[model samples]
Target: MNKNTFLGITGLISCFFFSGIALLQAQSKSADLKNWPKGSSPKEIGTRVADHFVVTPHTNFGKPTPPKVITYPESCTWYGALTFAKASGNKKLTRDLAERFEPLFGVESKMIPVPDHVDYCVFGAVPLELYLQTNDKKYLDLGISIAEKQWGPPEGPRVKEESHEFYKQGYTWQTRLWIDDMYMITALQAQAFRATGNQKYIDRAAKEMVFYLDQLQKPNGLFYHAPDVPFYWGRGDGWMAAGMTELLSSMPKNNPNRERIMKGYTDMMASLLKYQGKNGMWNQLIDDPEAWAETSATGMFTFAMITGVKKGWLDKEIYGKAARNGWLGLVSYINENSEVTEVCEGTNKKNDRQYYLDRKRNTGDLHGQAPILWCATALLR
Candidate 1:
C-alpha cells in the first residue's frame, strides 16, 4: 500500500477501537448504576425504598385511630409512597394509596381528637398535597375539613383538651404545638391557600408555626421537641427540618414570613451541628453524646442540612461533610432490602437522654423510610 493509504487506515482502526471501548464503559456504568453510592439520585433512592418496603398491601393504612381507625403514621407512609410513586413513575400505586384515605373522611366521630399535634398536621397535609398533584377535590376537601377541625382558631385550642400524657401537666393551656407539627401540616396549609385563594389557611399555618417557635426554641438556638420539653430530640428535630424544607418549598418567594422561616432553619441547623456525632449521626437526644446514634433522625437531619445548602440558606462547604457523614452512618444501617434499622420508635419524649436511648428501634416503618427518602432526595439534589 502507498504511505498515505497506510497512515489513513491506521487512524481509522484506532478510532474504531476507542469508540468500542467507550461503548463498553457506558454499558457497564448503566448496569452497575444501582450499586452507585446511595446519594446518587432521588429517583434511584426512591426506587430502592419502593422496592424494599412497599411489599405489603395497604401497609400505609394502619389500624385507624379515634372516630376512624386510620392513623397518621399510615398517612406519613402514604406520603412517602406517593413521593416514591411519582419519582419512580408508579402511577398505579400512587392512585391506589391516594384512594385509601378517602374513607378517613367518612368517619362519623373524631377518634383520637387532639387537633394541634403533629399527627393531625402530617395526616391532613399529605392528603392535601396528593390532592393537589392529582387535582382530586376529594383529598383537598378532606384535608381542609381536618385542618379546620384540628387547627383551633388562632386565639384558641385546636384540640378540645390537652389530655395526652405528654401535655397533661405542661404549663401551656393552648393546643400543644410540637416541632413535628410544622412538618405535618404547614405545606398542606400552603397548598390549601393556593388552591382556594383563602388566606385563612396560610394565616393559620403562620400562627401555629409562630406558636411552636415561641414555645419550643431553647436559648442555645436548638428547639425542644415540645414547649414544656427541655432536651432536643433528634427525630423531632428531623420532623421540623423536613417540615421547614417542604413548607419553604411551597411558600411564595415574597411571603413576609420567608426570611423569618429561613433564619429559624439556619439557627436550628447551627445548633444541631454542635451535637452531631463523630460518625455523622445525631444521638437520640441530640445535645448529648452519651445517647445512642439514631438513624431516622440522622436521615432527616441530613435531608434538612443538604436541602438548606441547596436553597442557599446554609453553607454547603461547612455543612456538606456533616450531611455526608450522616448518610454514611445511615447507610450502614440500611439492609439489602432497603429496610432501615436502628430507628427509634415512637415516643412522646421529654428532655431526658435516658428516654431517648431507651426508645426501641423499629424496622421498615414509615418513620424511618420517610426520612431516608428525604435524605436520599436531598443528597441526590
Candidate 2:
C-alpha cells in the first residue's frame, strides 16, 4: 500500500509540473499578444488587411486569360481572411467570407481546381477552416477529400525529377524538395490535424519539416531557391519561415521532432534579424545587399517573428521591436487601394542569380496580400 501510494503521489507531482509549465507558457503568449505597440497592433493592421481581401476580386493567376478556377495564392488569402475574421471577432466578415465560399458548394463546384499538385492541395485548408468555424460536415467532407489525395499513390504522369517512390516512404507523391512545398504541403496537413484531432497529420508535417531543414537549410539558416538554384530568394524563404511557424504551432509538445524543429525555427529567426533591411524589410535576394526591398517576404518574416514571440519560442524583449518595425514597414508598401507592393512575381527555379534579380515586382499580387492577413491574424490570435 505504501509503495502504491508513493507511486500515485509521484505521478501527481509530475502532472502538476507539466501543467504548471503549460500555464506559464500560455501566460507568456497572452501577455505579448495583448500589449501591442500603437500603429503595429493586430487589431488595426489585421482589420485593414481583412477588409482589403473582402473588396478584392478573384485573382487572374497572374496571366492575361480570365481566372476560371481558384489557386493556392487565393486559397492562402482566403484562409488568412477566415482566421483574421475569427480573431478580430468580426461576425459580419465571417459570414461574408462564408457567403463568398457558398458558391463553390453549389453552382460553382466546378470552379474548385483539381488538387493534383502541391499548390492545389492547399485548397483543402480553407474548407477545413470553414468546417472548424461553422461545424458543418459539408465543409469537412469536401476538405478531407482533397487532403487525403495528397498521400495517395501517383494517379498521373510524374514530373521530370520527382520520385514516385516517395509514397512508399509515407511522403506525399508530390514531394519535390522545393522550399515552397514546405508551406504548400505542411499548412494543409496541419489544418487537417487541427480540425480532426488526429496525430498523424501534425506528425507527418513535423517529420517533413525536419527533412526540409536538413536538406535545404543553409549554414546561416536560410534556404536556396532550390537544390541547384543556389540564390537565397526572399519569398522562397518566406514560405519556409511561415511554414515552420505553422507546423510548430500545431505539433504536439511530445512530438519527437519538436525540439529539432524549434532549433531550426529559432536559428532562422536569428538570421532574419541579421539581414533586415534599414526599412525593416528583407531584400528580394535575402543575402544580396543590392536586392530590392520585398513586401511579401517582409510580411511573412514579421508574422513568424510575432508568432514566435507570442509562443515563447523567441525572447519577447529582443524580437518585439523587430516585429513591430517589420509590421510598420510592410504596411508602408500598401497603396491607397490597400494593395501590397514590391512582391516578387511567381518564380521558377533557375541556377542563375540574374534571373532572380530581374524577376518582375508586382503590385497587388495575392502572394503579397496573403501574408499581411496572416501577420494580422498571428497578432490577433
Candidate 3:
C-alpha cells in the first residue's frame, strides 16, 4: 500500500479506537453507577447539581426564579448542595451557596409564626447550617427565629391530634399531618436541636414523628400520603424516610422517643425493601407495579437506606446491597448536564390514584435534583 494510504488507515483506526473508548466510558459511567472510579463520585455528582444552579443562578423552574426569592424545592436543593459541599470539604463552595439565600433568612415574617404553611418553612435549616459553620449572629438569630415560629405558641391554638384531617380541612400548620410535613418541619427542628443544644426542639421533632406514625403508618409499615390519600406517594414516603433519618442523626441517643423513632424508621426501611424495582429504582406509586420508575424518590430512598445502614439502624448485609442498587438506579436518571430526569413535579394530596399517575415529570426540577445531591452526600457519610 502507498505510504499516504497506510498513514490514513492508521489514523482512522486510532480515531475509531479512541471514540469507542469514550463511548464505553460514558456507558460505564451511566451503567456502573453504584461503583466509584469507573463511575461518578458522590462529590462529582453533587458538584454538578450545585453547579447547575450556580451557573444559571436564576432557574425558571422555580416559582420566583431564584436570586429573587427561594422556594421550597429550591431551598431543599440548596441545603443538599450545602451539605455536600461541607462533606466534600469545599469550604468556599459551601459559603458561597449559603450566602445566596441570606436575604431570605433575615425576613421576619418568613420565619415568624411559621409562615402559615409548612412549605414556606422548609428552608429554615439553611440559616442554621450557615450559622453552625460561620457562627454569625445574624444566621443564628434567623435559625432561632424560624425554630421559635415552628415551635408555635406557648399556649395558644395549637394544632391538635383531632385536627388531623385530609384536604386541608381546617388543617393548620401544626395539625396537618401530610407525609411531606415530616421533611418540611422535622428536618428544621432536628437542625434546631443540633445547633442550639435545645431539648425542646428535639422533643418537638420526635413527638411529631410519634404522632404521624400513629396517624399514618399502615400495617405494611409504609405511610399513607395523607388521611384522605390512601396511595403511598413516592416522594411523600421519601420525605418521611429522609426526615426520620435526619432527625435520628441529631436526636439525643438517650431521649425517651428515640426507640420509637428508630422503629418507625427501620420499619419504613423494611417496607421499602419490598418495593425497590429490579433496576434499583422505586416507582412513582411505590406499591404499584405499573408506575414508571422515579428518580427523586429513588434518590431519597437511597439516601435514607444508606443512612440507615451506615448508622446501624438497618442491617448492612441486607440493606447495603439495596442502597447500592438504589444509588445505581438513581444515577441513571441524571443526564450529561447533571440534570436529574423523571422527577415528579410538586404535587398535592389527591383522592384518585390516576392523579399521581398523571403527574408530570421534569428534568432539573429541584424536587428531583435535591434528592440526588442529598443521596450523594449520604453515600459519602
Once superposed on the true structure, which residue ranges of model 3 sit more than 4 Å away at CA? 1-37, 58-69, 103-114, 154-173
lDDT of 2 by residue, 1-381 (tens): 699999999999999999977854443334244564465567777677778888777777688776788878999999999998888989888888888999898898887978778888898999999999999999998888877888776776544335567777777888888999999888999999999998988887887888889999999999998999889999999999999999999988999999999988999999988888656688999989988999989988999999999888998877876786687678779887778889999889999888888989999899998999999898887
When summed lDDT is taken over every stretch of 10 residues in candidate 3, the lowest stretch is 164-173
Sequence-dependent TM-score of model 3: 0.83
Global lDDT of each candidate: 0.66, 0.86, 0.78
Please report how far candidate 1 places residue 76 from its true position, in Å: 1.7
Query: Highest lDDT among the candidates is held by which one?
Result: 2
Off by more than 4 A, model 1: 1-41, 57-68, 87-93, 99-118, 152-174, 194-199, 379-381
**Candidate 2 TM-score, true structure as reference:** 0.88
Write the residue-wise lDDT of candidate 3 on 76-189 in tens digits: 887788788888888977767866665453662342224445776766787788778778878778777767766554333454544444213312346477899989888788
RMSD of each: 10.0, 15.2, 6.0
TM-score each candidate.
0.74, 0.88, 0.83
Ranked candidates (lDDT, high to low)? 2, 3, 1
Screening candidate 3 with a backbone cut-off below 3 angstroms (N, C-alpha, C), the clashing residue pairs are none
Consecutive 10-residue window with the lowest summed lDDT within model 2: 24-33
